[model samples]
Target chain A: MEDTVEQPKAHGPHGYSARKDDHVKRLRRIEGQIRGLQRMVEQDEYCIDILTQVSASTKALQSFALSLLEEHLRHCVADAVEHGGPEADDKVAEATAAIARLLRS
Target chain B: MEDTVEQPKAHGPHGYSARKDDHVKRLRRIEGQIRGLQRMVEQDEYCIDILTQVSASTKALQSFALSLLEEHLRHCVADAVEHGGPEADDKVAEATAAIARLLRS
Candidate 1:
């Protein structure tokens, strides 16, 4: 039984916990907005109107991603750089890859 | 004026373009499903039914995240490990932080 007990998960360098609730709340609201868009489509709403809603929802997601990225840079990347070693290089490369993906989208 | 010319964005090691279309398509479907859930609520649909859709939608998002993670590991992480340098370390750290956020959610 003792062996079966799971160790706690490690938190990331970034203070993700600090903004976790806020991020979740924003996502939930975005979820609601998505639902609204579906309703508009079903009820024969204007095409432009539906498109507008879609654009808005996409923007919300992008904004959320940006904020998360900022947090990662400020905390995780900063920590790794301060440490100054192979691990520091790893963190920067990892972040660069992520940023590339985001921009490509 | 020459400086104003925007350089093309760099690609991530993972070849994100290889599956970018697939990811976008899945997201669009998820968006549609979200709309459906909204309609259910608006029409006073049963609580359980709406909850179920929400669950499904959430699962879809999770799956998408998993796929993206897989791609990152296969391409970006693998490349970094092979490179065996400071950049490699940075990439791994970046990815570790991302996984942490995903798991926390």
Candidate 2:
């Protein structure tokens, strides 16, 4: 087994562990951008203005996706492998295909 | 600074740490499924078969996404917040919007 670093146990009612404060923070900003986009569309903002923001949004999303992908590759997958079997292989495959689809989109 | 556990600084040319071996295994299975889908399409498999696979693929993708999302909420995002500032918030927001978009898809 690989070296294990015990993370702080975060208490929460959401089934999964408590999310990072930074994650929540990032989410809030994204929400603002989304709202801004909506306003732009409603106000008939310039195509360039809307598109520029859209592009920004897309890139931001891609970055976020990349970060999450990295973590999955490092943690959950690692844990699954350490534990063993065909199920792990199926899971990794499922994840990769999903990633390919995301990249395509 | 929070509790830091030094993970095996896996040696690799890949800028990021070496991915969990399990991730590769999952990816391989997903790849096989993709190939199977392609073959099925080439042979003009039944719509239901394709659709069923498509649905399965989508669910699989979503599951993968969820797993990644959980990790992000735990690690990178946690680190960012601990470090401090607006950049962290921005990143978290960016990630959140992307997730919302993904869930919608």
List the pairs of residues colliding in candidate 1.
A89-B90, A90-B89, A90-B90, A90-B91, A91-B89, A91-B90, A92-B90, A94-B90, A94-B91
- Please identify model 2 stretches exceeding 4 Å from their true place: A1-105, B1-19
Question: Where does candidate 1 stray beyond 4 Å?
Answer: A1-14, B1-105
lDDT of 1 by residue, B55-91 (tens): 5665565566666667667776777788899988987
Q: What is candidate 1's fraction of native contacts?
A: 0.03
lDDT scores in order: 0.57, 0.59
For model 2, which pairs clash? Answer: A26-B92, A26-B93, A27-B92, A27-B93, A92-B26, A92-B27, A93-B26, A93-B27, A93-B30
The DockQ-based CAPRI class assigned to model 1 is: incorrect
Candidate 1 chain B, run of 10 with poorest lDDT:
B1-10
Best by TM-score: 1
Task: Write down the RMSD of all candidates, one decimal each.
Answer: 20.1, 13.4
